[model samples]
Target: MPRIKDLRAYLDALAELGDVRTVDRLVDPHLEVGAIIRRSYETCAPAPLFTNIKGTAPGYRLLGAPGALSSAPGKPLARIALSLGLSADSTAREIIDALAAARTREQIQPVLVDTAPCKQNILLGDEATLDRFPTPLLHEGDGGAYVNTWGTIVARTPDGSFTNWSIARIMMIDGKHMTGLVLHPQHIAQVWQQWADLGEPMPFALVQGGEPALPFISGMPLPNGVEEGGYLGALLGEPLELVQCETVDLQVPASAEIVIEGHLSVERSGVEGPMGEFSGYQPHETSMQPVYTIEAITHRDDPIWPTVVEGEPVDEFHTATGLTLAAEALTQLRAAGLPITTAWEPFEGASHVLVVSVAADWRTALPGVSTGELTQRVNDVIVALRFENLVPRIFVLDDDVDASNVGELMWALATRVHPTGRRIVRTGVILPLLACYTPEQRHTATGDKVTYDALLPAAGKGREPRSSFRFLFPAEVQQQVLENWPN
Candidate 1:
């Protein structure tokens, strides 16, 4: 399959592949839409296209979980692979390897364009009303209807040297107002802080749908000073075509379905929160957050709105957020000259846990490794990275275990890990987003991150070869079962 330019093309491809289904019946944007998408995520079912949204206007539709796991046995993560312009049958390991390789490619900058599809239908100032769209109240417990679940927020430093692209949860405040709650750790918040220091509001543009890679790279934690558009351009093997925003100096994808230009006010603050996060928990309280007032709203003739369902494994959070981050981490570790051969976060872990595999012959990577000092060295390198903030635990595995396979990881965890000496605990600033932490730990923003050694000592009496189903059954016998078992 060719690279998907935007969300609409991906959805159309899903329909043709029988990977998506439409709900002809009316569905409420409140709890109903949430319920359906949640179930779809759990079952790895087809993507749900809600045609009869309760408050949808003509030419507007709601697409739930655009790249959620596919139910197809042959290619469960097929949708996620396609989102990054890979083959439908691409495995998780292949995707990670591809991303790691792309890190070495020269980033191609975006091409400047004028009058994009996103500007086909435009509303400025008072006309930039958000009430007309069917912004879904994803969760019943959510404080308000969220319109920016899967969009990209573009922000630039006050000096104009750095541009950050990220995904932050947003709540609809009114016709032309919205509030976003971003942690100070985010690059966007850092840019906002820089603007606040200058006593000026930050110019911003929110893109609802653009290239399929937009959300992927948005969730990706690229290095500081690097442009996301350029990185994405390299990944796609083509330059991203960008058009200047009407109200903001920054640019948005020309193929974007909806673009909202705004000024993120630093002085003004509003209450925002209690939405379900990828950690599978809701915030207990709401807090005063900066408000982003819309200056202009632009979109195509007929636009499809994309949204993600948080609070579970195998959703957009796990597949897109988890997969992309792991890929970037792999690249980072390699660049740092770590012995890591493969890295992945299992969907079963809700994207919080990381499994890193290195060469089984430890001496090959690190000299004088008998005392386990190299383990701590590699662990330190990973925990110190600014972009690898989501990881709470890193499981160091031997090359024998396939880090990409959840089943293989489970087996290694059960057999290789020890409760005492093999574990290395390092203290660090923990993000409050990690649901595993207690409220006290979250308040302190610090915790002991763990690294478990899942590799056997290279030369030891305890070290022994393992057996499995593949080894027990010869290829001839396996082929006979495949040839005759059905009959």
Candidate 2:
């Protein structure tokens, strides 16, 4: 396994693995190039590199669908594995297991360097120009070009002890200005709001493409005040090197491909929306978001622009966010002393739904209980609902069911759950993204939800033994049957 320290190194690794394919033919960045990449993501094809983007320098390039999919066999988790310091052959179970293990390790702090390759060339004050870069106008109806896609925005709390790295879309507003959507509940937005309340501009740095683990950690829903850089260091098994920004009082990865130093005005607001999101739908309203004044721009000689074309499930954004959320959920549940067996955010759900399989011992622990009791207990264990703006719909299952496999989970729900007897609906705490729920009902307040108890009936009450002889088949016979089946 190769350890990549920066975007250029990682791109080299991807090319070596035959995961990246370059198209030398001239392509337009306006809409043509984005459409091609969108089609590639839809088909789970190789990462496409547009080397000859219209109106851009020859060396300037765009890496579309970088974390989209893997062409390897029996390795659907390849992209995530690479991002998390695992081999390409790693399985989904292995990826989850690795993350769980890392969570238990000691934290490693990142090292700061005085100079780095990211500062090979710097544009300051009036020289900084956002239009010089090949920021893609991704969707047809998008309001403006988005400059930061797979980038990480670094911000610190008022006390400066808590540093946060997160992924949020940024749109180019002018030659030296941009607007970013910092959702109210997200850490970035929270930090900005604190500065806004104090009547101070929030200094920030946007780093585009560094170590894969860096961006991966940025999107993770870790506990508030957890240092993302330290988490990345732990994941990489080496301390990441950082350098101070030219204008902002912030530090960014020394090996980052491009660094944009800016400040968010506390009193300013600008139009932000109308771009197609990961849900494959655009919201009807265009709202005012925070405005950022770019102070400087720095990058290597030739930088590779990495972006996620957000729309529909199974896209790059969905996969990256899903893996991080699932891992974070598992960590949170275990920390709360819950015996969570498995957890998965189905790509089709787009982070709106979470499926959890818990240990069967819960049924015995709470005896003489009706199906509703199990549903309430299961709901109590879920931690995402407690998050202000991320209340996801959850489906609880027995240890035997695989949360990642929708078909298996559905089969269990159909055979074991009685429609009227096992379903429990609590319509009080839902996320706004769920189209099924009305906008007014999906606010941050507690909303309603439903839990379908699909666990097998307890050992008594006229029901057959949950663990029967037929259910425990010989392992060798099962293996033989699978081996004999034709593809």
* Candidate number achieving the greatest TM-score relative to the actual structure: 1
Leading candidate by lDDT: 1
The CA-based lDDT of model 1 is what?
A: 0.82
Model 1, residue 63: what's the lDDT?
A: 82
**lDDT of each residue in 261-327, candidate 2, tens digit only:** 8889886588986787777776665668888899999988877778778888778666777767777
Candidate 1 Cα RMSD (Å)? 2.0
Tens-digit lDDT string for candidate 1 (133-159): 878888868989888988999999988
Cα-based TM-score, every candidate: 0.95, 0.91
Against the true structure, candidate 2 has what lDDT? 0.74
lDDT of each: 0.82, 0.74
lDDT score for residue 57 of model 2 = 60
Off by over 4 Å in 2: 360-374, 383-388, 413-431, 442-447, 459-473, 482-487
Error of 1 at 193 (Å): 0.7
Instruction: Tell me the deviation in Å of residue 238 in model 1.
Output: 0.5
Where's the lowest-lDDT run of ten residues in candidate 1? 368-377
